[model samples]
Target: MASAGMRRRVEAIPGRPLPYGILGGCTEVIDVEDEHELLGVEWMALGCCPVEVWNDPCVGADESPGAPAKKQFCRPTIEHADPITVYAGAECGTMGWSYAEARQHAEASLDLGQQEAVELGFWTNHLAATATDLTPAEGPVDIAQGVAALEGCLAEQYGGVGVLHVPAGAAALLGCCNVVQRDPGGGPPTTLAGNCAVIGAGYSTANTGPGGIPADPGTAWLYITGPVVVRRGPAMTVPDRPGPSINYRTNTQRVLVERTYVVATTCTVCAVAVTTCPS
Candidate 1:
């Protein structure tokens, strides 16, 4: 969203990946080609989960685990595998829109805004400034269309769920962020002979096949990341009275894809300020 002049921090996985089960993922599935740098190379965990009504993705409306049960999402996410998968129940509404279209609109809007400012001599005080050179972005005014285009980018590798996940809550999460929830099965983070099997985030909730349609738009997209095998902390350390504390250094990268510079040139005689606007 930064491209749209909207500033946002790309939050990484909250903590070191739990060997066996990590709840959030979107890692290597989408935007791999379109925007490489922004792609959270390390298994991606959506920063925010939008809340809305859900529809069954795995099966039809007739079959579903019905009951108001408050249970944390169950799934597995480990390190070292390859790519993880993310899932969410989608049925019309924003989820029904196109990710590519949304992204494109945001990107183009940002690009034009920057150029408009520059062309109007809004940036560097060079006399060469005029709105005549500014060219408005082409396509639908509704950005969601361009942004939604991203949805199909990796639908193949991740299947349907890989594309988008409308998690458990939608409205409430409108401006919230996503976190990596780890499942504590107390099982070995790995498997060999006597060890436990680490299925990776790919093995997270087995595509529960979407959620049930609700009367209201209260929704949450439970997305999964691509799968990757992670090894448990050396058993030697966690024998009995010891707990393993995995360490990971966080890296921050600031990239400005677009810039807008506003400059004002007033006719010394008029004594009025001339402003530049993107039309």
Candidate 2:
């Protein structure tokens, strides 16, 4: 077993680069220290000034001028980033690979650690979201259905089109059913039916089985979009030394990485679609 001290050593790994993934595309990333304050008042704080005919068709000059009512929003919420980690172990005996091989293994572990941080934080937020925000559609949402769901939510929020995140399987289905517009050079689909940027969540439950989100047999294709804020705390340290495990008798050394993440919604309307995609 790796001790708490060993975990600290992992956090101290020098030259560790921040990880990137699809989450970056759809979220507002903010790096914070101990805690972050989400000012709820920032969302729709200003109201549109009421318009009236110059001739006082709407109201008489004797009446007092109307005041712009402030938009109602949630109170400020304090969020703390939570840690998520991944580890890899290798044998220290002669049977173990050479130093170069062990180093490569550690590097691979680091990569996985970074990916896990992004994917876990992204999906955990999705799964934890209220069903109303994370709306559920019938099984297998088509292009038109997906667009309606996404656009409806955006309208509710008084926001224009936003990024739409779908599972890989759902993306494939949409591509097959609709002519997704892409750049001439050929890359990921640039836009879906509603002129929305489509991102296939490669690490979603539908794609990664149990490793990603827990399976919900009732739901098939799930889509999420809106004003999402991802708050990241200090990056976790990677264990520099593959120290032998204190509990295990075998001469096994391990590397571990961990980081904190908090996913939040900026407004009342965060759209999500859950539908069935037949096998």
Candidate 3:
């Protein structure tokens, strides 16, 4: 997405939700603690057809008229929906930047939090596919096969292949075999392995579970498809209260970034876990 990142400037309209329809939800606010925000929240409940079908080839439509009264009542279930939720990041603060320099410094500080949020979302929503289970041994080839297996599992859930969000270390291994490809048009980088498209991102290796896997020594590929809902609130900057001008106090400016999102695979199942043992 480098080309898009460089050439296109996309910004959400302030005070409104930015809907990235890659996931299967909309208008769902997951991080709200208020009881009123939780009221009436619901998800689709798939129903079955009550009428039985005649399997006999000789049965004519008139002779095998199924129950005319049979009906399928499919509705949204109003309950506590388990949308894969990600909590808001802690408020980051910086002190002593001049008034003119505050905004730039604050923006730079926000980078780490934003990366953490991405990592958290990936960790929360991914489905793990490790080397021991998918392949005979650990290596780039095994990880590639793992990617294939993970994509299959993902397709079974959502009936289509998902993209591979790859870590840098894994990408290096996959790249050795020419499995990873750069976007010729300068878009976001992606790798095409088997039926899945892989993307190398900073968030892929965050919190690799109990093994404490880091990006380079281990292999982890997050395969995601189906509906993924990401809701991002705009970043706001303001003067720290007990203001510098109000009191002869420390000159500090605060940048508040509020982001709450549910990175989940709705009923269709969005993500699958794929991993490899340390290299």
Ranked candidates, highest lDDT first: 2, 3, 1
TM-score of each: 0.16, 0.57, 0.51
Name the better of 1 and 3 by TM-score.
3
Clash tally for model 2: 6
- Candidate 3 is scored at a TM of 0.51
The lDDT of model 3 is 0.40
Task: List residue ranges in candidate 1 displaced over 4 A.
Answer: 1-150, 156-160, 163-225, 234-279
| Ten-residue region with minimum lDDT total, candidate 3 | 16-25
lDDT of candidate 2? 0.45
Q: What clash count goes with each model?
A: 69, 6, 12
TM-score of 2: 0.57
Clashing pairs in 2: 10-237, 10-238, 10-239, 11-237, 139-276, 140-276
- 131-228, model 1: which lDDT tens digit per residue? 11111144111112211222222232232232122222221221222212222454332211111122223212221212211112221112222232
- Top candidate on lDDT is 2
Q: How many residue pairs in model 1 have overlapping backbones?
A: 69
What's the lDDT for all of these models?
Answer: 0.24, 0.45, 0.40
For residue 157, give model 1's deviation from the true position in Å. 4.7
